[model samples]
Target: MVFQPASGYFCRALGAVLVIAATGAIAFAQLTIDADSQYRYAQSRFDSGAFDEAIVEFNRFIHFFSTDPRVPRARFQTGMAHFNTGQFQAAAAIFNQQTVNYQGLPLDNEAFFMLSRSHARKGMFEQAMLDLHNLMAIASAADTIDQARYELGWLHVDQGRWNEADQAFGQITPENQDRFQVLNLQQALALSDAIPTKNPTTAGWLSIVPGAGQLYGQRYQDALTAFLINSGLIWAAWESFDNDQYALGSVISFVGFGFYAGNIFSAVASAHKYNRDRVAEYRDLLNQRRQMPLSLVPSPGGAALCLTIDF
Candidate 1:
């Protein structure tokens, strides 16, 4: 998921003011009343899950009471409304502001928690983890701690850091255990140990044989394709040279050389890509395991099969 700005309705509603004059002959009007009333209506609408109307009202509240002390609370509420409606970015911004302006307020921890959630929803795992860390540091509430740890583990899982995710999940106490969390951690930990093996250097393999690097990198199709093309060119070059067609042989020889060069380059690139993919896979697995209650169990050789068979 990615973060996106709020809809234009809030901005538009904030910009337009409907001023009602108390008397036709007088210019005096109920400015404060209008703002408060609009805010109250928005709150009521939000309570009923009418996010669209709530958004309209909240925008008006911000517009009318931009300097009021209640503005922070209003902003937080607006952000929650946006979140419930699936506006992740909007919710993130509101929650962030709530944290900054109402640091000592009782809702500060809640704001931080929501900020983490918004970041997670947007796939900003690093940012979400930072917020979760902060929440864990400051929040003493049992439920809050549990929620933060669970979300933190999820962020790790999203990034494929299975070990880290396992650690995070392991922090959850038995009192807070849930079936979903347990199952998720088990799956992530299993994946961490289930990836296919790969050779360290494709270059070494390619040096031994033209397309061996590609094969080592598990690119069987590419290896076969390169081998066929290069072999054909080599054969053609040899045949021309044997028939005393020096010029034709020279051209064919150069073509074969080009194929050889390309094979080497492809082999190096494949090796690098393979290594990167391997790291990413492990990292993501570790991240998922971070939220689980299970810890990493070390094996004698630092590797072990995650599956068992009954024979």
Candidate 2:
């Protein structure tokens, strides 16, 4: 047999290796494109406010592309989709899960923020505060840290803990201090002196004197209405009874007695309501809040999630 040149043998082996490498490269690239396309489609739906549909697509992306770098972002976006749909409990659960599962991502603070917001929306105020505290512990960025502090102040105000609110606000660096001061001022007003309410028991006792209880509750118009109606019915009942019209007197007396009882109940209820309204009105005045913008977007920043706080 004729011996082949060494270069020729080497060339044939190299060609075989190149063919296999190219085939593998082509398959890898196709996979990347398919995965990226699916993600972009899901993102487009999310951007269009197709939240329920987007959640399904995002879930599919996570299941099919578990190893993809975009999975973390996909998971976060699913939580956001739930939030937008007003499924706050589900949203908080998803966001909290992401914080533990994808701890190192820059998305951590954003997830925490969303989770806190979800709890707050559900009126789970203590849980919301706890999440905000967690954010404070984990966030090193100045804005993120400051945002947590600011929100904590508002939460304390919501709890009607003005002193705690002031303490939280005091921890702020005074960068946008006046805005916070305005909030604190509202908090102070919320907890400030208010209209004194008549005691319910005293109001019921006064109601027997007809209109006096309502007047004590500072309901002048109601007092006048209650006084006139009660007085007229009692007079009519007395006149019928004095004239010896037994049937008319019986009916009028029954009606007059019912009115008198109703007046007493009304006075006591009104006093209690007056006190509650005083607190509620002030609470409403101090109940203002805002949220920062969040995105799980790929950009020049390179991080999977972005948070842009507005103060």
Candidate 3:
């Protein structure tokens, strides 16, 4: 028996089915390719220092595949992108979300650590301490704990809070402390000892004794110079008046008065500046112990980020 020709309607139905199957397969392939392609593009942007653009691409990949295993990594990098681009608040938010939303994930510790940094960058020092505490609370993450404590100590030191710095740095083992040159804690404590502080008001009052004001400000050379110049001018002015050179005496007295007045102001200024410089010296020492430096730059249409991680 011979088979009859297929119907036109039947042929058309089979063609439709084939078209649907082919279209579905292509879509699946495209999705897979897109996830990888977008991830690579995002990474390239980061590597090329195009942090703002990288954030956009990274978020695009994450938005498309929220359930993909790579999503956590994308989330972390997204925070980094914001950090590199100087959107510190945005970075802190992203990192905070990762810690709260991605519990049990490996990125939780990292997220907390980065969150602390973002908060610190925003000058939310108290909030930064909270994040640092959260990072140290991860019992299973010893590495994160060490780093968090270290950064915490430096934060305290930066503010010249020696007691707090000592407390934070004390948590580490002796070996780790030595290895990290944790001597900043020791130095800070040492600096807390009462040292002499010159009072600006007293310095100004002492100016009535000529060089006495500069002497109180611990400017011995300046005191000597001021005394010598004032005395010389006064003597010259007196001699001019004694000789009846009234014009010369007037000029000398006028110039001598300015120097005398300036000396008093200079002494007061020097004392206050000395105190300010003392605080700044401690801060500079703390800066040397910072984990790393971070930078943000404006891009063509946006901002980008760079960070030097030492811890």
Candidate 4:
């Protein structure tokens, strides 16, 4: 009953297992290093504003390290690269996919925020608002919720929904609320009544008088031109008929009818154009005063939202 030396086959098998495990460990370590290097390189590109290059590097990292923990981050950066390059459609697609695939994760929050921004950049305000609402619903952190509300407020402002904007701004924490108020948003909102608007219906009705509609929209030159043309054609048609020029009179009358109808349509369209232009000018002024100023930047602890104020 004494211990004996193990068999040659057992020793050889043990050696083989050790060799395999060592090889795997080395391979894993090398993979980790490579992944980190690639990620850092991509980030450097992004930081330098070389967005096109950053996109390529980020994609490369994701492709080569699909299972790495940083894969999600790389994917996010790729979406951001597209966004920075003004490729809103591509960026939205990426963020939408990320939000769907990474639901309930921190990445999902970022994806939702970026998706809303992408939609907003494309002037899809409704879609952007929906995205922000979704973010607010899923977000657990106070700061994230505040960020969502802030963006929602801006979207409301973009739509000229002043009351809604105020509500959204009111939901923010008091500390940040003061910053929003400094935009003189109240002053801009007060000017709402002062913005002159033309009723398309009134314009169309006035146009029945040929040029009256245009005058109502304050288009004096158009009114004069329309009135002169309509009157001149009417006179010419009447003169032709008086001279027994039946063919000429009929042709002139038809032409006059077309011009008369066109004048009415022009007035209606002019009124719409006037209103549209006025609202646009107002929004432009608001935009100049109401900058978001908050942006997400990379930090040692995941990411941080930073607000920049320009004095």
Candidate 5:
């Protein structure tokens, strides 16, 4: 028959089990404390505008506390740090990953918006629009949908797509309209149509005469320069031909004709530049009038949006 364990052996085994349990509990508490400290340190770095350091600390928190409830916030801050550093592509990637990882959560909406903004910053308008539209489609909350639409309008504005921006703004529910910079934005959009713009085609046609297109575009200096250069070359060519210097005349004529064509192209380009500058000026004015909503306020538990009217 098997020998039964002694009473002393059973007592020693129970003591060892209790000691192990106590040690485990202490270790768990220490881990929690360490995680909290790490997160706090990361947030401090971010608050100080030390984005590079913040990114490192945030990554550390994410790595060490993968199961922590604050992981989502840490991930978001990491992306925001990247954004603040102008690493737009990197920021977009992080935001996009968050959207996937936190699908159906509030973080997902925030991620979508940030991802779209990052894309827009990188001049990836198509991708930005896609993200915003996707958010609008999936969002059931009026506030979320309205924010998505508002951001969509801004994206269109960035691309000079005024009609599209107007449409996007129009889709916002009337009740939520007051929450945005709607009146100024609508005024800006309306003013876009009335802004004086040069027609590239008309400018090109006017350039048939050397310097005429530049003059049409109100580039007086360029017009004068083109006119003088073209006239001097034509006169030189004529004199050369009259003096029987046929080779010199041919060269001068060829150069003069080249300059003439270039003058026309320059005029057309000037007109286009004028139009672009006008649009940029209008955009700048709109920016001056609108109160941009980009400030992030740190809350007790997380970050909150300070303003509702985001650019």
Candidate 6:
């Protein structure tokens, strides 16, 4: 049988099309299989606490399935993997991106919470506070709000902003006070009434009346410190005087005099600070009373103190 060139050419073209289609379908199947395998591997790694490995696999899954509906979940898992591994900054970045990319998504609250924690860990206190506020604003469940409020209080405490911390802690409802929330609230209340030790000049306050400034500053131990320091200097001056060392005595006297002067100044300053703090506290109480209807009348068994520390 003689082969017609035209029929042979048509056959060749048809075969080429079939080969191309088969090759494309196989590539697509292989791609799907690889994606499924990567996703499973990522999940397994996460389950085993191999966060770094999980992150790599999750990233691969995300890269392969960028347009897939499961992409958000994959990204979220990747961020969580980073968070579990203590790579908070990287986790935060991922979470932030997730929120931006998937706003109004179901995972918004989780992403916001993670971002807030990351900011807190990184010492970006103001940003953390804002994120916490965002979480509270968007939280649908009471428990979630309570948790966010508790974390917010700790963030304030970490920054030494005790008044704000107290306010945050006070938001927790009594019935929902978990051990963590209750303990943190108690700590916040204690810290609220106490002055922070950020100022080293507090030491100078003790120099004035031996322990007067420290006592005013609500640092009883610091008062003893001031007294001991002054006593030691005074004793040194007395010994110099008794030994008939006029020059040495004069030098010690001068040093003592400066310390004494500093102590007096510190005492005055500390007293001023103490009074100012007390006034502020009273003002805050008044403001609270004004804002809440419950504060209109005193309770029959005395006012319900939110949280009070004995010492």
- Point out where model 5 deviates above 4 Å: 1-33, 101-106, 294-303, 306-311
Top-down TM-score ranking? 5, 4, 2, 3, 1, 6
Any idea what lDDT model 5 has? 0.85
Candidate 5 residues 113-173, lDDT tens each? 8899889889899999999888877778888888888888878877889889888888888
Q: Which ten residues in a row have the lowest lDDT in candidate 1?
A: 302-311
Give the lDDT ranking, best first: 5, 4, 2, 3, 1, 6
Each model's lDDT: 0.71, 0.79, 0.78, 0.84, 0.85, 0.68
At residue 197, give the lDDT of candidate 3: 71
lDDT of 2 by residue, 1-311 (tens): 99999999999999999999999999998767467788988989998989999999999999989998888779888998998888989999999997775353457767887888788889999999999898888767666777677788777767767667667777766675664564555456555465455699999999988888898888889999999999998899889989998899899889889989988998998899888887667666665433345545443237455653322
Q: Whose lDDT is higher: candidate 3's or candidate 4's? A: 4
State candidate 5's TM-score. 0.83
Model 3 C-alpha lDDT per residue in residues 234-272, reported as the tens digit of each score: 999999999999999999999999999998998898799
- What ranges in model 4 sit over 4 Å off? 1-33, 47-50, 67-69, 100-108, 297-311
Q: What lDDT tens digits, residue by residue, belong to model 1 across residues 1-311? A: 97656766666655553323224324445333665577668779987989888888878888877886556667767887888888889899988877774443345766787788788778787898999888777777776677678777766766767678778778887777673365566565766676655554646566446778788888889889888888889889999999999999999999889888888788878877887787676765555444332222222235222221111
Per lDDT, the best of the predicted structures is: 5
Q: In model 3, where is the ten-residue run with the lowest total lDDT?
A: 293-302
> In model 6, how large is the Cα lDDT of residue 297?
13
User: How would you encode candidate 6's per-residue C-alpha lDDT over 60-85 as one tens digit per residue?
Assistant: 88887778656776787888788777
Model 5 Cα displacement at 187 (Å)?
Answer: 2.6
Q: lDDT score of model 6?
A: 0.68
Model 4 clash pairs are none
